[model samples]
Target: MASYASKQLLSIAIIFFCALGHLTSAQIVTLEVKEGNSTCIKAELVARFSVAYNTTNGTRTVTFPFPGNATVGNRSSCGGTELPPLLAASFGDGHALILRFSINGSQYRVESLALEYNLNDSSIFPNSSSPSLVTVKTDSAGILAQINTTYRCESSWPVSLGGGSGNASGNASVTFSNMRLQAYMLGSDLSRNETVCTADQSVTTVAPKTSPVTPAPVPTVPGNPERGNYNVTNNNGTICLMAYMGLQLNLTYPSSVQNKTVQEVVNLQPNQTKSSGSCEVSNATLQLRDDRTNLTFSFTLNTTSNKYHLSGISITATWPDMKEPFSASNGSLDYLRGTLGRSYLCSAEQTLVVDQTFAINTFHLQVQPFGVNGGQFEAAEECQLDEDNMLIPIIVGAALAGLVLIVLIAYLIGRKRSHAGYQTI
Candidate 1:
């Protein structure tokens, strides 16, 4: 009878250990639903349920159906309570689940189970490569209170959420519904934990316009005319004249007469013949003309003191059409006395005249020939001469003429008287 009692106690202990293992074992609950092609949603719950029995009573079996269209698989064990098979389901929005269980002749019921799901993955998260978190919450009567979770993979695996506009190559979405999850009672509520995964995508491109540039205007400048005049005296006393327009100049001998020197002291009758060397030319004039400009000069000869043998020449010029001032300069004077050619000489003393003329719009002188010395000449309206010293030669000539006339009359009267005294012998 003692061996029989020992065997009964050992069998009871074995049954209690089996029931404890069933209550402590874990089960998996999966849910899958769809929203559209652009999003993906999934959820899972790992849970264990337990039932308590009175110590005096023997073991009891409890069977329950999972809520909604959930199905069961993969049974497990726990401590002092038995865990039912795993439950899972899939449906559209707004689905419900109810869990019913009978433990030790007492019934426990949880009703009106609904899941509130949210996916926060959009174009707002620009730099995030990972999918957004999925949140699932149950009403007060459900076994799981709330779950913030993620899934391993999503249909829209890689997505670019950025600022621009273009179409995505492939678009897909995921969802979750009617997932039966089990949990133990803590105070007055039942709860489970889970994670769901999702993703987002976008593309954008743009083309910009360009602008044109404008060019700056070119500037205009007025042209300047070339102008200058020069005079040269050779060894034979002939004068050379040169005048310029633009870069061109007419180089010619204006005077071919050799200059004569005046004697320092001379007494002669009014009509007396004097050698050319004893008299010099004076009161000379030069006139130069062109279509746009005119130049004139009056000169005198001084054989004794003038180095150029010509002096007292004053220059004047006028430009009828030009509003600007005309300028000229005598740039050089080279006296090549012994090197002069024969054509530069003159045969006799005579008056020098020059009437060089042209017609042109622009004139500028670049070079002046050598063998002459003078000041620069500029275009002007009038030039005055010193005529006060010109009367000395005139007065001297009158006095000499009067003296010769008186002498001639006295000689004639004396000759007549002498003849009368001879009495026609």
Candidate 2:
């Protein structure tokens, strides 16, 4: 009977330990940010103090909150309570990913993950298995830099079917009406060369047993005059991609010009046009991908007047992303130097809210960049500054001036007629 009791006690103790062990083996998810190229970034998530193969779906569901107080925006797949779809997909991958995160409010589709784990854990038990930690790292610096330095222009490209994947090309002329146009042309060069060729004996009527006849050298096509690539610099540090409303992308190229020249010419333009020549691109979108942000933009560009208007730009990025959209305006004016400056006037702070149907996590961003340059009114093009409210002040000023002029004219005419009547009487 005593022996039976001892066995029962031992079994209960074993069960208790098993339950305790499971609880103690739970893993914690943590993340780190690493830097990368301007276009993309690397984000790292580390599952710490974990037992092998013990960290799965349930364990991962724990929210690893990021400290960046980004404006939590839209993520279409699930409700705002759950992980955004793109972040979920990127994180759901077997390995840790250096994926797009969010900045302020933006979203992206997560793609690949590279994960690592340590394999040494024996402190808890005398004969226990070794434990490892899973770490993920990505580039936040790269993302911020990309946002700061990058350029954006949207155009519809004409699509062609002759190529395997099909080809698309278009050129929408972008006129920098108010913007300064500075150009430099490189001189074209030409050279001559001589070569010899041997004729086939079968084709030539060779004297019986004579050597093969030498053929005239073929002429080489001369290299066409090519333009050098231009470099655009913001002399005042205020010029930005979003400032111009009359901006259109030019992609068409003349057949005679070499492709190198074509690249050089457009490369020098104030805003780089994505594709080249007479072809115009419509229904185009802008995509900004990086470790901290994945931003997708959809907008329109007018064909005839070379005007660009942004419809909307949406983004899908990391979870816990947040922002309050705000608008501010500041301009520069140098009377002595005649240097025009710009200012920014943004709308009141508004949170970004995304519809939850696209099945992908996304964030959002919007800007016009008029304030970045000094004077919206004095910009080269009339519509370069597109503030609906700015027109009100101008209308009121015109009305007030007209009213003053009418009152003065009535006074002057009444006085003149009275003086004339008195003289006549």
Candidate 3:
């Protein structure tokens, strides 16, 4: 029948759009910034949100992402030609993510972020009558800090931001995941998409860069750090942490209740992931999940200094034959230390033992406080192991060159002595 054929077509359409990833979700909600008569920027943001709320027993967390075709209301505000433009993606009940822009002469940047959530919304937060509007602001984390550049990332990892130090009463934590962005432009149209990010890599930093002329290129870090950008801001909008790096987790557990131990490798990347994290001053936490395994990384600042280091790790995983979940955790650790404002980079693989059954590792990794020039990683620090590896070749070449010079000098001296002995002959 004709009715049956129409139903089949509808089902096919749903599957196809879902396959396109977050891009399809944002396609229905478009935000644009304009200047005078020309459209300056076009953006489609597919963001995932996780909010922790108070429950009678304890704190419970809920994660929700805007679905495809969920843009039914005035979800976007993009028609403006003011000196500093504004764009917003609103999800009803006063929940929204708002971006404020600032322009100077020929350049523009994302000046601030304002995120709002409703504590009274029964659907978002169950059995709560806290009737107060909530708004969190990030004062000046310049997201698109470039001159006429485009920012695009469709990888599954999505940039992770927020976490740590939440209000004591209202919510224990809040986090945002840019599940994926498709061909988003900032300040201008896409001129070959200047900035791109994937699960294994990113062009990161949350600070804005300003210049009268063209801005310089944001530094590039290569060699498999698997770096992804992250930002954390307090209620005042001051950036507390900025980080980028690749993360890999190693889990050792019994394949079954009585079987021998087996190891599983999980890569923390955006292209294949469902991840969450929060950046805060003095402490940072990152979580990355791939396949059936999930990892939580806890980093802390040393009491003597602001150097951040990995302090703990926890993992949860599922196996094919197991009826119950498997988990492992360790809280006391000191690894991957670095200064607060700068980055730590190393090309050689390094591992940290969390316990007898679990470990964490990374190679070519870089991380820093995400609030610097254009939110880019600041001057970097090299790990000792990687530095040692680099030193080997240089030391060998220098030693060889020194021996050759020594031999040549001795030969010349001997010839001179022989000439002296012969005198006028």
TM-score winner between 1 and 2, please give it. 2
- What would the TM-score be for candidate 1 when compared with the true structure? 0.16
Highest-scoring model, lDDT: 3
Q: Per-residue CA lDDT of candidate 1, range 202-258, in tens?
A: 011211111111011111212332233334334465553322322122111112232
Candidate 3 residue runs with Cα over 4 Å from true position: 1-243, 257-259, 266-269, 321-323, 369-373
> Each candidate's lDDT (Cα)?
0.25, 0.24, 0.52
TM-score of 3: 0.43
User: How do the predictions measure up, each by TM-score?
Assistant: 0.16, 0.21, 0.43
Deviation from truth (RMSD, Å), model 2: 34.1
**lDDT winner between candidates 1 and 2:** 1
Q: Count the backbone clashes (under 3 Å) in each candidate.
A: 37, 70, 15
Q: What is candidate 3's lDDT per residue for 1-425, written digit by digit as tens?
A: 33444454455556544554432233334555454555555665555555556656655666555544433234333434553456666676767666666655544555555556777777777855344556655432324323455544443221112222223222211222242121223434445434432221333444223222323322233334355655555456655555555666655555565465444555567566654667664667767677877778788875444556666778887758444677888776545656666777766555555554455556566766433455567888766555434544665576557556655665565566656666774
